[model samples]
Target chain A: MAEILTAKKLAIKVSICLAVLVAVMALCAMVGTQKISLKKVFAGPGQEPGQNIDYEILVGVRLPRVILAALVGAALACSGVVLQAILRNPLADPYILGISSGAGLGVITAVISGITWKFWGGSPIAVFAFVGALATVWLVWCIGHLTGKSQVTSLLLAGVVINAFFSAVIMFLISIAKSEQLRSTVLWLMGNIIEKDPAVLGVSTVCILAGIIALFSISHRLNILTFGQEEAKGLGVDTAKTTAIAFGLAAFTTAIAVSLSGLIGFVGLIVPHGVRLVFGPDHRQLLPVSAIIGGAFLVVADTLARIIVAPAQLPVGVITAIAGGPFFLVLLAKYSRKVSWLK
Target chain B: MSGIIEVKDLNFGYTPQSTILKALSFEVIQGRFVGIAGPNGAGKTTLLNLLCGLLRSKAGSIKIDSVPIESYSARKLAKKVAVVRQEFVPVFDFCVAEVVSMARTPYLSTFGFESDTDKKIIDEALEMTDTARFASRPLANLSGGERQRVFIARALAQNTDILLLDEPTTFLDLKHQVGIYDLLKRMQLEKGKTIVVVTHDINLSTQYCDEILLLGADSSYQYGSAKDVFSPHKIEKVFGVRGFAGKIGTEKFFLPLGKFAKDAHIITTNINSTTKK
Candidate 1:
């Protein structure tokens, strides 16, 4: 709800969220199997870089993993927010657009076919996943456009059909895969955040940040869009243009997240919704706060995944589902009675 | 010829096989209140959509302020005309003021935030619609009529010269229905807006509108002042209901005599008690 929205209030809110994220990230970064002293991370006077075990584990290992999780989390969450608005459906999430399934198929193809391709620090799987996601989005867009019907409904139908088809293909590939290939395929499908490539991490950070900025710029248009396509048009929004752009950007960001960290679940669905409840439905407040909080949430989940099994790390996606499923149920039970806003 | 909204022989349909509006032509003069009434599937909403360019009139022309509707971009047309929907169930809990503030979309760019002047306009809209009291409350917390008023406020905030509404009084209680019409009348008399509403309440439309457009199921219509167009014969012909036409004060009203209206002395054309001095 609106409260005489001012730039100052939004700035203050985002700053508080950013501070919380920093605290959460710091706490999670220190929670791995090896206890890391902050002194080793920064290195006092005579200590050589990466010389200490604590330094190597904290700065070298935990830091990159934490950053990747944060990036993917933010990407998925903000994309979820945009998709929810554009689709005007509460159940809509980043994966509802079929980008994740598309990426999953790509990962399977790369794993089973054993054809490696690399570009700018991207592994074959990541590259394949990115391509698959984008291609699926393009196909969906084409189908939606070709139908020339209700944009939202067409997109949803296309996405669901494509996702179902791809999931079937993925299952088929998994059934016949060699043992090692099957292991890799299952691992990617479950989602992981283990990128040692600095270029990939840095590039992903820049892309995710840019995507979030783009979404923020369209936040006002998005607010109107949530009120159905015709109503948005009644308010003078170019519903077609806004939906296409928001859908594309959300898909792009989701694709990036999926490529970098396999098929992580629920952060997008849970984070935006929770943030909306607390911050109200204003996207100007919702987008940035959800991104920061979403990032922090996954970092914590990833941390728990790492420490729960000690040296044997669980895929971060497994942790998210194990955590997210119960949290989502709780949210439904508590808020189902209160959601009187819609018919 | 001085028409703010001029639709000439408009024809439309969701599909080519199922045409809804057929060769419809009418003009709403600027600064007047007009009502469009028809039975279900009579293309009343289609007409409104055509006027707003939400639906293209494949075989005809709709002009706003003497310019073709297609000549202006959506944003540009929205500056001259605003639309108020029956209800807004946006699936999110937007506050009254926030929902109203959304009317400022055409005025603001993608990169532009609402300025103080825009805020003042929103406040004024809320004030005009009498929704200012609950401006901070979640829209879901409000009653149906209150929610309708909030949408009216949103349209008012658009500050357009023309306001078009589709079944604006649907599902509202009698009081809120009258309240919405009163507000619309005020919008015409005070703000100098050209008003058009599609409504099922033919009696209320006759009371408030300067002119009435009675649409028939067979692509025919009657456009005249309420006294000229809203007769017992036309009402019965168009709506398939027996109508008793009478006057209360200066405004004409209709009474629909149903098949099972109940054998009560309550059914009266007794204009004496109901008529006001």
Candidate 2:
């Protein structure tokens, strides 16, 4: 019908998704291994120590973890949407930047070297991961630009090579490490949501939110980029500059997420596909909508991980890989009768 | 005035040892339908990419309306030219209107917001291409011909003065082939848009183009009206197969001849001298 996609319409769509995110976060916060009352949240703030364990559990432990899941979810999914567009590969997920392997190498090296795993407020692994992942991405960036032309193909090739090399190192470390260290390393690789310093959450929240806004600003150019490199240039996009901007923003956000959430899988891979399957692939809607839905998907996954084991929590990453894969396939099977995954 | 598009001494290759186009020179006047026809690996597509500024040449210059192409910003150039690539199947399945809306990228504000005028232009493009019937449908739902038409509609939505296409007929049958060529011809005639197509279909180009630029192996080229440029010997030399030229209603067509044909000498016309330009 050639109806106008007015500003009002875009706002409404995003608002609806935001509403759903809020609903999911609220529901997940209510039902954890430990019973918490929503009434406590509305009741007057706890002014003294030894305030009800219910208040401490809800506000300190459960609520922060749920919020962290949402933030990481949003970051990974948003990165997935933009990366798929610019890289011209639907198989590109947050980990395709080699973030998981980079982070994995950090965890494995620290464990194998006999560095205490729980020191620095249980953040030594997170610190190592944040540095290693960012360093690997920086290495890929330099390699992609060695010819003074940072082509997406060059960047992608660099990522693949770096990912393979780092993963091999991680596997070698795991194979030779002692049993106790290997156990901790494996748990770190599997990924989980844990309570964090308020400062870390606040800083990550700012970085990720800014990254989403930056990506949203460039979504229109990304639509043209899907037409391949030469063709995108033919359409008058400054392919080099636009690609650089999108890649840098998406990469930084993915690094921040992995540093915070340790290596949550499948949210980055499945959320964007599910969102694209539901809403068509227009980046204008796809970016924000995928981000909101990605947050909710992870919250639900984390909540189920908390309860399914009942007093013994599973890593949220395991639930994402286990539950999200079948759920995505079901969606694919139901909808693929109409349209293909990609052609 | 020479033409709306001009090129001189253009050279390009992925590397110095593998040059694709060598000192290529050509021009297309405004409102003319020009076809770039050539054999495989002869740089037809490379030349097209050079024309649109997708790839820059190291040796020479391309100009639009006497202004060097490098001087034009990407957005400014996009308003003057729109390109329809060969079989561009994107990873995601955007609907017809959604894909068409992308053509307005160069025209949108820095924030990429659309105005009423952009919507009107999009609507008109759909109507012109006859794709408005399935404007709401996903591109996957359309037939081959319909999808090609939708791509053309996207180009038209750019509202450019010049349009370029690469093998719009690939993977299409005869009817769709004719339909696509007809659409391009109509655009040239009715809308006064300069058109250039790089294609392997020499026969169809012979019927539709005002001028033909036949590129051959080793950088040799012949540019003239189809009548002046096409001949059985040239076809055999370029494509490495013998062919006979047949005439129908002022239009010439080529039919390849091989040793397998029965009694091929009897029907041979030896019309090379008769067809001399």
Candidate 3:
């Protein structure tokens, strides 16, 4: 009977998530530059043979951007789910371990130094971002190990220090940058979805997808980890190795998302928490649902960022921040009293 | 050699300069209920950690079913022993059933899906722990005693032969403590589980445990039946108090004795009459 109830709950959650995804995708497709009809949107960017321009605009440009936004959003949200579980902190996000700042630093460094080598004519920024994110996470791990206190607080504090230091270095680089480079760097900080080269998008998708798969595969371990490290170990989880892998995957996905979308925040922090509130904290459900909802949320946010001001696009980061800030405050107002569990 | 758990000359510490456990050796016979007692920092938790392979011993060896503990992988060890620690903080608002299902993790594959047998085990653990009524309730909403029971339920779901509990009654009131002890005793007797509990409540330990291990500073340790280990002399030596043991309603209790005031006069005849009564 309990199993039946759980199955029903899971089914309800999946259906709701699918419904939300469909609604958001439809909204995203219908609200763009031309305000295409639902029929046109559903028929999917191609109807007649001669009218290739509309098809190209719809399929080539808008479709990829929306798909990329969804993929990156899902990746970030799922990474947040795993990280929060492993750290045993509700406030933990993909960026809490310094992945975003590290990737940002790498991108800024590459941009400032004019190191523009492309792998198969793709953006070097994504590659540099991933490498930098992994390197910084390793550095944080080493520091934590050297100190012999790898507690969550110590790791978080280390990330904060590294984030601040990296931000300062990136700022210094920006200060010395030429006008064109400085403008690009500033715009990158604001985050944009335009000009995503196909090759860059493909590589970023693959990286994010791999990280998502790795994380989802260990969803059960992630759930056990929420009981804290010692209990998790008692339950036979190799706490050290599993934690490292989960953190690495979260960092990797966040790095790819940051590289592709340029520091889209709050989606990683908000979407998973929201999903948990609705579906409860079973990672087998939470991870995948958070991913789907996160993808849909970002796709809608990106669409709004495009159409909100027309012709001139607002930065996707700004929209997420604006949306997530209020959502987070509402969350705090509702759940802050219950956070004594942290004690 | 036939015991479920055996530790020999086990020495462990956080650092070389500060040893917590020194040559600690004990055996828990199959299906025995053993209690470990000591003052704070008596290395009770460290010893339990060593037994469960949560912390590697610096010296000596630990064996489960005559196999070197270090030789068993974490999953194998978990299948043999489950620990309910003193501090259990759930990071998420998981339902009680979900929390209980986590105990089946050791028996599951890498994917860790709950099989029909696994679900039955979880249900049984929940029912055994008296948490089945709140199976749908969020764990965060449970009282401290309830949450502690949920942790135990999760451990029970592991279905191990040995259960190690560290200060399981620390935060509970007297009623809850007795309830938990009674539940643990039932589990031991009914399931034939080898149970080891670490606690500061010597009286409770003496009442419930078949064997008691007393740990003290300066590399001192004693292991025997509760009657043998909880004598007045050993109690005074360990607690630095003059204590009197007496029976009340078929239960034994130890109470600290105090010296009379210097200005007060003791009446020997009255004392003899009171004792006779």
Candidate 4:
């Protein structure tokens, strides 16, 4: 009887919080830099008496940017949850695993070498980033598996080494790049989601949605995996296949997010940890709640980023780093004893 | 197909030459509580892993109910066998109920929500293990013995016919150790669970287990009824210690005299003198 009540209460809480988030997002959409009235926002395409200007700024500029922030935030948080569960470490994130560096390298390669391709109206940068992320994940898995068993310590050390090496290579590429390419690369590496292209937004939306759905589908297997690989296998999880699917989808979502915006850090690491602290570690609830909260959190952060400087926006990544750095330190201190990878 | 296991001439090693368990064979009847006992590095845990197909044998075979262990998928095999490991500390804060509910993973859908049936089983498991009171508490807050029982509750929720435990009493206190053995014994008799436990407590095995397999040096094992296998000669020879087996009110125990004596004559005289009593 008590169990049922707690579960019901949690469900009610989540629903209420989601509704509140929707309202917050709506208010934020209205209050950014210029306060456009609902009339102008809904006025459609018109050239009469400031109609086109308000509509373009509200619908074309602000709405898409907000939507893109929500999508990328949800993607990063979901990726964090999956990586942390699989690696059995609280500190495992796309950025920590060298995945973001790998994706950044791919984007730089595309930018400097003038190698471009378009897929389903998404930029060539996203494709290169996705390929790079997947390749790095595969390489890390291989290195971690050299002993025939993928120990958590080995996987973490391999990630650390790969992250360092990939970052150096990215720096080398940045040094030789043209001035325009360098600025673009720098902006991307610092993380910003100013892309106003509807086609790219549409592609990213579909991919992030599909990736979250796929992640939610495997959340059960991920719950078992948190007990570690051997126990998960004993409980009947196909550890190898589940790991592959999870890494693949997480990398795909992260690649899209990284390419859409520059390498945003900490949203993935912080959101899931915050969610776990509040909701406990049942992945069924963890994945979805984290996704929702992550989206809302980023919407708020990006809003702050825009308004903080008044016409000169600070990158959202800067805000997350400032906030999440101390939180990461606290978590490291708390969990270092239990998690060997922390050492 | 309820808990009958057959292992034949299994061989395993991390490397080619350094074999752990070689040419091993054993058969377990239905509904028996068996204990695997040995000194350190006897490959008892390795054998348990092989039984559940967590570790593949380099040679020979293991069959559960006349089917090869490899024939069943990991998920399918989990429906028949559940294992409680010695060491598992979750990195995140999973409450006791949530950890126990993870046993329903094989039965859950892609989204992994627990159904009504899964909930009932989880409740029953928690109640049986006496972990229902701490259902809302984070597992990290529990004491070692309480956490151990919670793990047992998880394995119970798995609802497999065969339950395997690897050193379930490692970090537990004396009372908790006996409590766990008593719980397993009750399940063996009342619930008819086929249990295989790897324990270093030879006395605990002798008091409760229906049969005990004593692993010896050179990848060998001696298997029989507890009464047949717990003799002083076999204990001393296998464990490399001087021990005398004695019974008080039909409950047998082995008391180690000391490490084997350096003088062969003194060892022989001592063994001969103790056996005469």
Candidate 5:
């Protein structure tokens, strides 16, 4: 009887996730200029020349944007789930440990120097962003290790300090940037899903997917981690090793996401919490559900960003922050009611 | 069913120079309900941490079933011994059943899903600890006593032969304290589980334990039957309390005593006379 209930619950959760994904996909296709009909959108991009008004737009623009949104969203959300579990802090987001700040700093540096193109004009921004993110994670870990206090509190404090430092550096770079360079940098920092090469999107999608898969594979261990470090060890987890792997995966996913879409915040913080409220904090359920919800959330947010200003196209990051900031404040207010030792 | 744990010349400390346990040695035979009693900073928790491999011992060895603990892999050690810590701050809001099921992690594959056998063990543990009723309730919502029982259920689900509890009754009320002790005693008798409980409640130790280990300062330890080790002299020497041992309804208890002033007798007599008049 209980097994039946468990099966039913699982099915309902999966069905809801699939339904959300489909709904978001539809919204993404329908929202942009030259709206495509659902029938034509799914009918395999009309083959007849010139009769395919919707085909070019669907295949050329909307599809890549939607796919990018899903990939970046999933990456951020999955990173958030792992960080929250490891740090045992519900307030922890993907950027809690300065990954986003580092990525931002790297991009600002690239823009201020008029180095828009990669070395030899190839993927410079993404490469710098990834490297910077990695460096930031490494620095935070080193400081945590040096303190000889590997507790979550110490790691969090280290991240906060590093984030502050990186934020200041980014501001400095912005101040020195030329007008055109500054405008471009501002657009990048505001974060958009515009003009991404399909190949770069595909590569980033694979990276983010791989990181999410690795994280989900350890869902059970993550469940144990929610019990805090000592109990996790007592339950036979190699706490130190598991902690490192979790943080590494989180950094990897966050770096790739930030590389793809410059510094999109709050999707990571919002989606996982939303999933947890529904799914009850079981990472086995929470990770997958958060991924789907996160993907859908970003797609819808991007759709709104495109439509809200009409033709001028506000940055997707601006839309998400506008949507998410109040929600985050509400959550903070709710969680602050009772001061929990674990948080 | 012969199971024995021996700690030989164990040395441990949080810092480099300040050793908490120095050359501390003892042996607990299988199925014994051993209570560890001591005053504050007596290294009771440190000793338990060493036993469970949470803290590495600087010197000596711990052996279970005549095999050295250091020789066993962490997973293997988890299968043999389970530690129930005094305070647990759960970061997520997991159901009681899910929390208890985590004990099967060591026995699980890399994926860590619970098998049918694992489910059976978890169910049995929940039943044993009487937490089955609230299995679906979030652990955060439960009362302190309930949470403690849930943790015990988790330890029980580990299916280990040795169970170490670090001050399990620290925050519990009197009823819950006695209740947990009774549960441990029952498990020891029925399952023949080796139970080592570190507690500041010497009275409970005297009433429930098969044996007691009194930890003193300067790396000294006294171990024997509860009666033999819980004497007033030993209590005073270790706890800096002038106390007397007394019996009330087949249970021994210790009460603090103090020297009398020269006018104490006269004052007592005057009070008695006044009451009589």
Candidate 6:
């Protein structure tokens, strides 16, 4: 009876959170660069409808940007939860294993070398970035495998080493790039979700949603994983198989998010960490809650990014870093003192 | 079948060069509280890992019931055998209820929530281990004894016939150690479940366990009733220490005469004689 009541209470709490998210999204939609009439925004074109200034800005510019922010935020935060569990590290995030740097390297090479191939309207750079992410993940796996079975420690170390190596390669690319190429690549690396192209956003939306669902589906197994590899195996989980699937999905979601929007930092790390701090770590609750809260957070941050400088927009990544960096330090200090398991 | 577990010349090693358990053959009958005792390097924990199929043996056969252990699926094997490790340090704050609920992993369908029956079983397990009151507390906040009980409850919630423990009482106070052993004995006798424990305290184990499996410095083992296995001569031979068998209040125990104490006495006598001269 008490268990059922607790389940009901959790449901109520989640519903309330989702309600707040909807209200915040609505508020963000209205308050962007300029206000849009809510009725006009919700009402579709019909017999009495005609193109207007508010309609064009709201539907054309802000809506797609807001949607992209939400999607990318959801993907990064979900990936953080999954990566943290599989890697068995509190500091793990979507980019922790050098996936982002590898993607950045791919994008830089594509832009600098003048590669021109467009499949389904996505820029060649986006496609190449995803490929690079997958390749780096494979390299990490190979290194982890060489030592023995894929121990978490070996995998984490391999990620750290590969991240350094990829960052160096990216730096070399930056050094040799033409001036114009350098400007464009730097903007992409700053991470923006204001993609005006609807076709690219459509494809990435599907990918991100599918990846989030996959992570959520396997979340129960991830809870078992937190107990450690041997314990997880003893509990009937095929630890190797579960960890592989989880890592693949995390990489998949993160790759898609990075390809869509350059490299938004800290949404992954802080959102999941914050969620765990509040909800306690049952991945069943941690995974989806983190995603929802992440979506809402990014929507708010992107809105602030647009209006904070009037006409000129700050990169959403800049805001997240400014906010998340100090917050993470405080969390780290608190965790070191209170969390016995981290040691 | 005379026993639930039958081993035929089982051999295991982490690497090819050194064998941890060599040509081991033993049978553990159903519903027996068996204690495995050895010195520091005797591979007691390794033996428990092998029994639970957490580690694969390179040679020989281990059969659970009539089927080879290797033939069972991980989930199937889990349903039949549950293990309580020495200690667990959780990376996240999981409540006692949540931790115990994880033992239902084998029975739960993929992505399935716990059924009412599963919750009932969990409640019953907590009750059995006297951990019901701590259900809402974080596992990390509990004392060592309390955490140990919670782990036992988790194993109980697994609903297996065989329960294996590896030094479950390590790092626990003497009172907590006795409490844990008492709990295991109660589980075995009252519930008729087969229990296997690994420990360094031969006397406590001998007093509580129905049978004893003694591992020596060399990769060998002896299995028999406690009386046969815990004899003074056997203790001295296997442990390389002098032990005298004695009785107190109709219960038999052994006292170790320390070899280090004799050496210290000789050194002290030499120093005193030289100073007096």
The numbered model that scores best in lDDT is: 1
All candidates: DockQ: 0.53, 0.54, 0.53, 0.54, 0.44, 0.45
Q: What TM-score, to 2 decimals, does candidate 6 have? A: 0.93
lDDT of 4: 0.82
Q: Which run of 10 residues does model 3 chain A get worst, by summed lDDT?
A: A1-10
Ranking by lDDT: 1, 2, 6, 4, 5, 3
How many collisions per candidate? 0, 0, 0, 0, 0, 0
Candidate 6 lDDT over B47-69, as tens digits, reads 88888888889999998886898
lDDT of 3 by residue, A1-343 (tens): 3331244566688788878887787567656677544455445544666454555666667878887889889988998898788888888888887787788788888788898577657667767777888788888767656654557667777878888888888878888889988877777777777757777778778878788878877888888888777888899999888988988788778877877878788898899888777566789889889999999989988998998999889999999999988976787677655444533
**After best superposition, candidate 3 residue B121: deviation in angstroms?**
1.4
- What candidate 3 gets wrong by more than 4 Å, as runs, is A1-12, A35-51, A116-119, A330-343, B1-3, B248-250, B258-277
lDDT on C-alpha atoms for all candidate structures = 0.84, 0.84, 0.81, 0.82, 0.82, 0.83
The model with the greater TM-score, 1 or 4, is 1
The sequence of per-residue lDDT tens digits that candidate 1 reaches over residues A274-326 is: 88776778888889899998999899999888889888989999999899888
Question: Per-residue CA lDDT of candidate 5, range B1-277, in tens?
Answer: 5457999998888889898888888999999999998888989988888888787888899888899887877788889999999756587777789888888889988645677788888898899899998898777778889999999999999999999999999999999999999999988999899999998888899999999989987678899999889876677778876544577667778655445754445433332232222
Question: What TM-score does candidate 2 reach?
Answer: 0.92
Model 3 achieves a DockQ score of 0.53
lDDT agreement of model 5 with the native: 0.82
True contacts kept of each: 0.58, 0.54, 0.57, 0.62, 0.49, 0.51
TM-score of each: 0.93, 0.92, 0.92, 0.92, 0.92, 0.93
Position A164, candidate 5: lDDT: 99
C-alpha RMSD over true interface residues, each candidate = 2.4, 1.7, 2.8, 3.9, 3.8, 2.7
- Worst 10 contiguous positions by lDDT, candidate 3 chain B: B268-277
TM-score of chain B of each: 0.91, 0.93, 0.90, 0.94, 0.90, 0.91
Please provide, for model 6 over A1-343, each residue's C-alpha lDDT reduced to its tens digit, 9 standing for 90 to 100: 2132244555676788778777877778788667678677666544543566577677777778888888889999999999899887888999988788889988998998887777676568788889988899889888988897657888888889999998999899899889999987898898887654887888788888888878877888899898898888778888888999999999999998888788999999999988887677888788888888898988988888888998898888998888778876787677654455654
